[model samples]
Target: MSIQLYGLCETHSSEECNFYCRVCMFALCKECKKQHDIFEHEIIRAYKVNEVASFRLADLESLRDASDICPYKGNGRLVEVIYKRGDGIACCHGQGNVVECESCQYRLKSPSAKYCSIQCKVEAVMKMNESESVTNEAKRKVETISEESASDVKSFTKRPRE
Candidate 1:
């Protein structure tokens, strides 16, 4: 009496059907059956079904309690960009005399004027003339009062009472 093995294929033979090995779970042809049986017969061991079920249940519980939020989220802080050495102008947030151009909005290092272009420098100076005039007038008024007060004090100190 011979038992027929179902789904055994050998290279395009319609009489042979493909089947997976019970041990290694690899598809085997009729010619490869002997090679799979040699390895499978040695490693046939019974496993506890209850232990496998408990392990899978623990994995599912841990996955359910796991956090979805990222730990590194919003951790980066804003940093100020520093200018190169000998650039004469400090950074935009630093104590530098350099500024952006009002007309073109270009950032440039300037010691005397806030603008990089000659036209912008000239315009800035002209626009600032009114404030300069007011400052000069205030300084002159203070100097006049100081001088008059000094002379009055000197004259009073020099006079002798009758």
Candidate 2:
């Protein structure tokens, strides 16, 4: 594409912008391009941005590296955006941090997963069953004792019948 002046550069008011910085999302002139180059910024011709099929100004700014502070206390860890779909929602987590399984306390396969594996889920179910059975057994014993006590009390009270 032929080099054309897009507009007056925002940084340098006197010079016209011929290039754009993909990282900073700013239009820059030849003089300003030199400063952007120091940081290895992606500088492209201003007109060519529209020609690129995948170039979207909004997407470029939203996909920047994460710099937000982490929520977990005492570690001062910083969370990073792991993935983002077209829906604009982001799945973020601290670097090297992992979610644990609700049942086994082992590292989970994924953030949304409840148990680490099928075995952990099965074990948790089995434990719940065992506890329920024990509780039922105790209730049965209490009922049996209560019935026996009632029968004995009736016999003793009805004594001396003529």
**1-162, model 1: which lDDT tens digit per residue?**
011123445553554423334345344454555556665332211111322100112222333211211111111421111111123333365545555555344464443323433334334556789889999999999999999999999999989888
Q: Model 2, stretches more than 4 Å misplaced?
A: 1-99, 109-113
Highest lDDT: give the candidate number: 2
**Global Cα RMSD, each model:** 35.0, 22.2
TM-score of each: 0.30, 0.34
Q: What residue runs in model 1 are displaced by over 4 Å at the alpha carbon?
A: 1-99, 103-117, 160-162
Q: Write the per-residue lDDT of candidate 2 for residues 1-162, one digit (tens) a residue.
A: 112346676677888786656567566798888877756576655322223212223323354321121111112321221111113222334536576655545544356544433334445567889999999999999999999999999889988879
Q: Please tell me which predicted candidate would have the highest TM-score against the true structure.
A: 2
